[model samples]
Target: MKSWSSYLKQFAIAIGVVLLIILVMDYNIRLDELNRLNEKATIVRAQATQAIQTQVALQTQIAEATSDRVTEDNARNNGEIQEGDQRVVPIPATGVPPLEISVPTPVPTRVKKWQVWMELFFGE
Candidate 1:
């Protein structure tokens, strides 16, 4: 009877140790999973914020597009003219370019030896 009881006690202790080890391992796995989820949530939050900011920027641009200044600029870009506006269409000169005026080139004056000597000494 004593030997049997001793054996049973040993088995119970071993079982308890194994259960503790399994519980600790499960806790570690759960902690890792929780951290991963938190990081993913942070990333998703940032993406959402960026999306909202982009939405706001697009709305601002839409509002600006409806303004008078933008409308006028768009019209001018499309070559649209208002009433009483005269559009001058430029005609390209064809066949030959306008005759260029010819001017005679002035001949260079001769520098004397004394003048060269004076310039070399004075640096003028």
Candidate 2:
């Protein structure tokens, strides 16, 4: 009877040891999964932030496109003029265009270092 009880106790200890090992392996796997999920969440947040910024930029562009100034500029680009604005017709002059007078830049002559030293000593 003592031998039977001893065998049962040894069996229970063996089962406990195996269960402990399985639990430790499961905990490690769960920890690794949690880390992977956190990394993915970080990436998703960055993408969401970029998407929001793009949305804001698009909204700004939409607002600017609908403004009165932009509309007027577009109309002018399409050659539409407002009422009471006179269109001027320019005639090309047969005479020559006026000449621009520019002062000539003096050319600097480079001298040798020894010539410079000779000038410094004897150019008095």
Candidate 3:
């Protein structure tokens, strides 16, 4: 009877340890799932920002293009001008091409990913 009771106690302890391990494993799995969800959310937000920027860029380009078209149309439609209208001058093309503007292109500054992360976390 004593030996049976000892074995039962050992079985109970073994079951308890298994349950504890299972609980710990379940907690870690939930944590991992939560971490994955957070990462996905971050990626989704970045993509949304990028899409918004792209849409804004496209809208700006369309507006500029439309303005250029309107200007060109106005210039073409002005057939008979009364007074104070600027005369359109047609310059004869010479053998040599006109000199191009020599404005220097702006150079992009180098940025590190960690710097961006730090700026995001630390407010600049």
Top candidate by TM-score: 2
Pairs of residues at least 3 apart in sequence or in different chains that clash in candidate 1: none
lDDT (tens digit, per residue) of candidate 3 on 1-119:
56988999999999999999999999999999999999999999999999999999999988886896766777668764436767677987989888889999999999999999999
Provide the global lDDT of candidate 2 against the true structure.
0.96
lDDT over C-alpha atoms for residue 50 of model 1: 100
lDDT of 2 at 58: 100
Candidate closer to the true structure by TM-score (higher is better), 1 or 3:
1
Q: Which consecutive 10 residues in model 2 have the weakest lDDT in total?
A: 87-96
List TM-score per model, in order.
Answer: 0.60, 0.71, 0.50
Candidate 3 lDDT for residue 48: 100
lDDT of 1 by residue, 1-124 (tens): 5698899999999999999999999999999999999999999999999999999999999999999999999999999999999998899689978898999999999999999999899975
lDDT of each: 0.96, 0.96, 0.89
TM-score of 2: 0.71
- Estimate the lDDT of model 3: 0.89
* TM-score-sorted candidate list, best first: 2, 1, 3
lDDT of 1: 0.96
Q: In angstroms, how far off is 65's CA in candidate 3?
A: 1.8
**Per-prediction count of colliding residue pairs?**
0, 0, 0
